[model samples]
Target chain A: MTRHRAAATLMPLMSLALAGLLVVAVLDLPPQSGLAEPVAGAMDRAGVDHPVTAVLLNFRAYDTFLELAVLLLAVLAVWSLGRRDPIPARPVQGPVLHGTLRHLIPVAVVTGGYLVWVGSSDSGGAFQGGAVLGAAGVMLMLSRPRELPMLPAPLQRLGLALGVCVFLAVGTAGLLAGHGFMGYPPDWAYPLILGIELVAALSIALTLVLLFLGGRHGH
Target chain B: MATDPVNLQIYLACGALLFVMGVHALVVRRHLLLKILAINIMGSGIFMVLLGVAAGGEGGVDPVPHALVITGIVVALSATAVALVLMLRVKAATGLARLPRSGPED
Candidate 1:
């Protein structure tokens, strides 16, 4: 009891001291507004108008590739930790839930696609699109309990691996062509990025739902 | 695309406060879930700082940091999933949400 109490006091003091240092450092940051123009040439090389998408898909594609790999690693770790959990007992669904499910899935799919497309020109991207799709899956899981058992195991695995496999394949091809890993040729950049993003969104959505499902192969 | 520097500073300050709060929570909380939550909050604070710093140019916010933050958010989500599963495993083994006593010190 005494140890806990002592920690409570000390932790706040340490936090405050750290915060003071952070404030001093943050205060020294000279604010620069507008798009940092330095990266414009790199953006042009990326072949898309949206600077953020260009950065993610071209300027620094390797980071994103590794990020996908890391996500897969996390899921693998989770799976290794235990046997498949039995699906939870079905909740009694109200009429309202049924109605919402009827409408929500279609909206989520359309919006997810829209986000994927918008990512190239404006805001929204694979992650956001995938989130919407994952929500739809979760809602479907909730509304249709029987489908849980019916979810095929192999399909889920494919969804989980699709993003990384596709990305790596493209990157390796770039290397084979002497363009280096994750390099987008001046002409191939647009199609390659959009195609990769579409697959990535699918994989991301599946991985999220798989995370929710938990255990090996989400069985 | 020019933005008020004062507003930007406010966001950075908020991020700093969040970081400290997350640190405090991580230290003070014994529950595994709360610790994971504090870590997530800490990640959010860092993302906010990145955004604040990157938003300083006239051509809209720099896309590199924006992409980085998006990637960070996804990575964080997976990490939380792993943490939650670990917590579940720990609970199953020990029947406790908080850590078990390491020895007879108590």
Candidate 2:
């Protein structure tokens, strides 16, 4: 009991001390220009027009690829846990919501596609688009009629693996062509990055929806 | 435009406080859900700090940190999903949504 009390008391003090140290560290950091200049200098050579896209897809493609793998791994872990219990039927169907969804889902799909397309030159990208698509899928899952039609098992699996597989294939191709692994040739950067983003966006959308489902799809 | 130094410091301080608060919550709270939430708060704090640092640079905002934070967000989402499922399994197996009181709270 006394030990518990001591630990409880000490935790706040420790946290506070840590916070103070962090503030001091932040204050001590010298003001300096970040990697903006270097990134800018390399922009033309980068496949994409947007600085963020350039960094994400070109300069640091490995990190993004691993991120896709992490998403896939997460779904695998969830599926291994057990089957997802079916959603209980809602007694009261709100017609308004169903009506709205009827008009909204197609728009959401178009918006997601636009986001992915605009990503090369703007603030939107694969993740943003995929998230939007995932939201639409979730809406469908939640509000659709009880006998919701799920994608066939194989197709679902394909969608889930699409991102990482495509990314790996592209990276390996780049390596075989004398560009480093995950690197783009000077001329092929744009098309290659866009292709990766499109497939990655599809995979990301599927992964998010599966994560929402929370377990294995079928029996 | 470069962030004003004073504002940048303030943002950094806020981020630091958020991270500390998250750590405090994660340690003090016993509920599995709260712990997961606390972890997310900590992630948000780190994102804030990274963006603050990105903004304080000389010529332009750093794209590297922006890219990093985007990756972090997606990773966090996946992690949270896995954690939530694990929590559900724990609940199903043990019939408790919170951790057993084997620590300070006990």
Instruction: Give candidate 1's error at residue B45 in angstroms.
Output: 0.7
- Per-chain TM-score of candidate 1, chain B: 0.90
Q: What tens-digit string does per-residue lDDT give for candidate 2 at B1-106?
A: 8888899999999998999999999988999999999999999999999999999888889999999999999999999999999999999889988997777542
Give the Cα lDDT of each candidate: 0.82, 0.90
Name the runs in model 2 displaced over 4 angstroms: A88-91, A216-219, B102-106
Name the docking class for model 1: medium
Task: Give the docking tier of candidate 2.
Answer: medium
* DockQ values of all predictions: 0.56, 0.77
TM-score of chain B of each: 0.90, 0.94
lDDT of 1 by residue, A175-201 (tens): 898889999787999999999999999
Candidate 2, A68-178: lDDT as tens digits: 999999999989886556664543567787778888899999999999999999999999999999999877777763556689889999999999999999999989999
TM-score of chain A of each: 0.89, 0.92
